[model samples]
Target: MTAQRACGLSDLVQDEARRVEIDGVPMAVVLDSNGEVHAIGDTCTHGDISLSEGFVDGDSLECWAHGSAFSLRTGKPLNLPAYEPVPVYAVTLDGDDVLIDPSVTLDVN
Candidate 1:
Protein backbone atom coordinates (compact mmCIF):
# COMPACT_ATOMS: atom_id res chain seq x y z
CA MET A 1 0.00 0.00 0.00
CA THR A 2 1.07 3.57 -0.61
CA ALA A 3 1.41 5.21 2.77
CA GLN A 4 1.74 8.96 2.84
CA ARG A 5 2.72 11.26 5.63
CA ALA A 6 -0.32 12.92 7.17
CA CYS A 7 1.21 14.89 9.99
CA GLY A 8 3.49 14.80 12.97
CA LEU A 9 2.28 13.26 16.21
CA SER A 10 3.08 16.47 17.99
CA ASP A 11 0.78 18.36 15.65
CA LEU A 12 -2.28 16.65 17.07
CA VAL A 13 -3.83 17.17 20.44
CA GLN A 14 -5.41 14.41 22.41
CA ASP A 15 -9.14 14.07 21.76
CA GLU A 16 -9.03 16.53 18.88
CA ALA A 17 -9.49 16.04 15.15
CA ARG A 18 -7.46 17.44 12.31
CA ARG A 19 -8.05 17.68 8.59
CA VAL A 20 -5.48 16.32 6.19
CA GLU A 21 -5.50 15.66 2.47
CA ILE A 22 -3.66 12.80 0.90
CA ASP A 23 -3.85 12.02 -2.82
CA GLY A 24 -6.66 14.57 -3.09
CA VAL A 25 -8.81 12.76 -0.54
CA PRO A 26 -9.81 14.67 2.52
CA MET A 27 -9.31 12.82 5.80
CA ALA A 28 -10.18 13.46 9.39
CA VAL A 29 -7.32 12.35 11.61
CA VAL A 30 -8.20 12.14 15.24
CA LEU A 31 -6.19 11.54 18.38
CA ASP A 32 -8.63 9.70 20.60
CA SER A 33 -8.95 10.08 24.36
CA ASN A 34 -6.94 6.94 24.82
CA GLY A 35 -3.96 8.39 22.93
CA GLU A 36 -4.55 6.33 19.83
CA VAL A 37 -4.82 7.78 16.36
CA HIS A 38 -7.61 7.12 13.84
CA ALA A 39 -8.11 8.23 10.28
CA ILE A 40 -11.45 8.46 8.55
CA GLY A 41 -13.00 10.22 5.61
CA ASP A 42 -13.46 13.86 6.39
CA THR A 43 -16.87 14.26 4.85
CA CYS A 44 -19.90 13.07 6.72
CA THR A 45 -21.81 10.36 4.89
CA HIS A 46 -25.15 12.00 5.75
CA GLY A 47 -24.11 15.47 4.65
CA ASP A 48 -21.41 17.47 2.92
CA ILE A 49 -20.00 18.69 6.19
CA SER A 50 -16.42 17.85 7.09
CA LEU A 51 -15.96 15.50 9.98
CA SER A 52 -12.71 17.21 10.81
CA GLU A 53 -14.74 20.19 11.83
CA GLY A 54 -16.79 18.03 14.17
CA PHE A 55 -16.35 17.48 17.87
CA VAL A 56 -14.69 14.41 19.30
CA ASP A 57 -16.73 12.63 21.94
CA GLY A 58 -14.74 9.75 23.38
CA ASP A 59 -14.05 7.39 20.49
CA SER A 60 -16.75 8.91 18.29
CA LEU A 61 -16.65 12.00 16.18
CA GLU A 62 -19.87 13.97 15.90
CA CYS A 63 -20.77 15.77 12.71
CA TRP A 64 -21.26 19.42 13.44
CA ALA A 65 -23.97 19.97 10.88
CA HIS A 66 -26.39 17.17 11.66
CA GLY A 67 -25.19 15.69 14.94
CA SER A 68 -24.28 12.36 13.41
CA ALA A 69 -21.69 10.52 15.46
CA PHE A 70 -19.21 8.24 13.71
CA SER A 71 -17.00 5.67 15.33
CA LEU A 72 -13.34 6.50 15.10
CA ARG A 73 -12.23 2.94 14.55
CA THR A 74 -14.72 1.53 12.03
CA GLY A 75 -15.95 4.67 10.35
CA LYS A 76 -19.48 3.51 11.05
CA PRO A 77 -22.10 6.02 12.02
CA LEU A 78 -23.04 5.53 15.63
CA ASN A 79 -26.07 7.84 15.59
CA LEU A 80 -28.64 8.75 13.03
CA PRO A 81 -29.25 11.08 10.26
CA ALA A 82 -26.44 8.95 8.82
CA TYR A 83 -26.73 5.27 8.01
CA GLU A 84 -23.79 4.83 5.67
CA PRO A 85 -20.29 4.38 7.00
CA VAL A 86 -17.44 6.61 5.97
CA PRO A 87 -14.14 5.22 4.71
CA VAL A 88 -11.53 4.53 7.36
CA TYR A 89 -7.83 4.57 6.50
CA ALA A 90 -5.01 2.62 8.00
CA VAL A 91 -2.67 4.66 10.12
CA THR A 92 0.95 3.92 10.87
CA LEU A 93 3.23 5.72 13.19
CA ASP A 94 6.77 6.01 11.92
CA GLY A 95 8.70 7.47 14.79
CA ASP A 96 6.90 10.77 15.43
CA ASP A 97 5.40 10.89 11.95
CA VAL A 98 1.78 10.00 11.37
CA LEU A 99 1.35 8.14 8.11
CA ILE A 100 -1.89 7.20 6.39
CA ASP A 101 -2.74 5.13 3.38
CA PRO A 102 -5.87 6.36 1.67
CA SER A 103 -6.01 3.36 -0.66
CA VAL A 104 -6.20 0.95 2.25
CA THR A 105 -9.50 1.09 4.11
CA LEU A 106 -9.66 -0.48 7.56
CA ASP A 107 -13.44 -0.88 7.86
CA VAL A 108 -14.84 -4.08 9.33
CA ASN A 109 -16.65 -6.53 7.10
Candidate 2:
Protein backbone atom coordinates (compact mmCIF):
# COMPACT_ATOMS: atom_id res chain seq x y z
CA MET A 1 0.00 0.00 0.00
CA THR A 2 1.09 3.51 -0.69
CA ALA A 3 1.78 5.59 2.38
CA GLN A 4 1.26 9.34 2.30
CA ARG A 5 2.78 11.65 4.82
CA ALA A 6 0.00 12.95 7.04
CA CYS A 7 2.01 15.15 9.35
CA GLY A 8 5.13 15.40 11.39
CA LEU A 9 5.25 13.52 14.68
CA SER A 10 5.69 16.81 16.48
CA ASP A 11 2.60 18.26 14.84
CA LEU A 12 0.35 15.99 16.84
CA VAL A 13 -0.34 16.70 20.47
CA GLN A 14 -1.18 13.94 22.89
CA ASP A 15 -4.91 13.22 23.29
CA GLU A 16 -5.79 15.48 20.38
CA ALA A 17 -7.18 14.74 16.97
CA ARG A 18 -6.21 16.28 13.67
CA ARG A 19 -8.20 16.35 10.47
CA VAL A 20 -6.42 15.35 7.31
CA GLU A 21 -7.27 14.44 3.76
CA ILE A 22 -5.22 12.00 1.73
CA ASP A 23 -6.10 10.98 -1.82
CA GLY A 24 -9.40 12.83 -1.41
CA VAL A 25 -10.37 10.68 1.54
CA PRO A 26 -11.09 12.46 4.78
CA MET A 27 -9.28 11.02 7.77
CA ALA A 28 -8.72 11.71 11.42
CA VAL A 29 -5.23 11.25 12.77
CA VAL A 30 -4.79 11.10 16.49
CA LEU A 31 -1.94 10.88 18.92
CA ASP A 32 -3.14 9.12 22.01
CA SER A 33 -2.07 9.63 25.58
CA ASN A 34 0.57 6.94 25.29
CA GLY A 35 2.26 8.73 22.38
CA GLU A 36 0.89 6.33 19.80
CA VAL A 37 -0.54 7.41 16.47
CA HIS A 38 -3.83 6.28 14.96
CA ALA A 39 -5.70 7.02 11.75
CA ILE A 40 -9.38 6.48 11.09
CA GLY A 41 -12.26 7.66 8.97
CA ASP A 42 -13.11 11.24 9.87
CA THR A 43 -16.87 10.86 9.57
CA CYS A 44 -18.70 9.60 12.55
CA THR A 45 -20.82 6.50 12.02
CA HIS A 46 -23.78 7.98 13.79
CA GLY A 47 -23.83 11.29 12.02
CA ASP A 48 -22.19 13.50 9.43
CA ILE A 49 -19.93 15.18 11.95
CA SER A 50 -16.17 14.97 11.66
CA LEU A 51 -14.49 12.72 14.18
CA SER A 52 -11.42 14.89 14.27
CA GLU A 53 -13.41 17.53 16.07
CA GLY A 54 -14.22 15.03 18.76
CA PHE A 55 -12.53 14.59 22.08
CA VAL A 56 -9.75 12.05 22.54
CA ASP A 57 -10.03 9.98 25.66
CA GLY A 58 -7.14 7.59 26.05
CA ASP A 59 -7.54 5.05 23.25
CA SER A 60 -11.04 6.12 22.30
CA LEU A 61 -12.21 9.14 20.35
CA GLU A 62 -15.53 10.58 21.41
CA CYS A 63 -17.81 12.28 18.96
CA TRP A 64 -18.55 15.80 20.05
CA ALA A 65 -22.00 15.86 18.50
CA HIS A 66 -23.37 12.64 19.91
CA GLY A 67 -20.81 11.40 22.40
CA SER A 68 -20.14 8.21 20.49
CA ALA A 69 -16.83 6.76 21.54
CA PHE A 70 -14.75 4.77 19.07
CA SER A 71 -11.66 2.74 19.61
CA LEU A 72 -8.58 4.09 17.94
CA ARG A 73 -7.10 0.66 17.32
CA THR A 74 -10.18 -1.06 15.86
CA GLY A 75 -12.50 1.80 14.94
CA LYS A 76 -15.35 0.08 16.76
CA PRO A 77 -17.98 2.15 18.48
CA LEU A 78 -18.09 1.67 22.19
CA ASN A 79 -21.14 3.78 23.00
CA LEU A 80 -24.65 4.49 21.85
CA PRO A 81 -25.91 6.39 18.80
CA ALA A 82 -23.17 4.75 16.77
CA TYR A 83 -23.55 1.09 16.10
CA GLU A 84 -21.42 0.97 12.97
CA PRO A 85 -17.66 1.18 13.03
CA VAL A 86 -15.59 3.49 10.86
CA PRO A 87 -12.58 2.49 8.79
CA VAL A 88 -9.28 2.36 10.55
CA TYR A 89 -6.26 3.14 8.41
CA ALA A 90 -2.74 1.88 8.71
CA VAL A 91 -0.31 4.32 10.30
CA THR A 92 3.45 4.23 10.14
CA LEU A 93 6.16 6.36 11.66
CA ASP A 94 9.32 7.20 9.80
CA GLY A 95 11.52 8.99 12.28
CA ASP A 96 9.52 12.18 12.97
CA ASP A 97 7.11 11.80 10.08
CA VAL A 98 3.66 10.28 10.40
CA LEU A 99 2.59 8.35 7.36
CA ILE A 100 -0.88 7.03 6.61
CA ASP A 101 -2.18 4.67 3.97
CA PRO A 102 -5.69 5.69 2.99
CA SER A 103 -5.98 2.72 0.67
CA VAL A 104 -5.40 0.27 3.48
CA THR A 105 -8.19 -0.08 5.98
CA LEU A 106 -7.66 -2.42 8.89
CA ASP A 107 -10.39 -4.99 9.57
CA VAL A 108 -12.15 -4.01 12.77
CA ASN A 109 -14.59 -6.85 13.06
TM-score of 2: 0.96
lDDT of 1 at 43: 97
Candidate 1 lDDT over 1-109, as tens digits, reads 5899999999999988999999899999999988999999999999899999999999999999999999998889998999999999889999999999888897475
**Residues 2-25 of candidate 2: C-alpha lDDT, one tens digit per residue:** 999999999998999999999899
lDDT value, residue 97 of candidate 2:
91
Clashes of 2: 0
TM-score of each: 0.97, 0.96
Off by over 4 Å in 2: none
- Residue 94 error, candidate 1, Å: 0.7
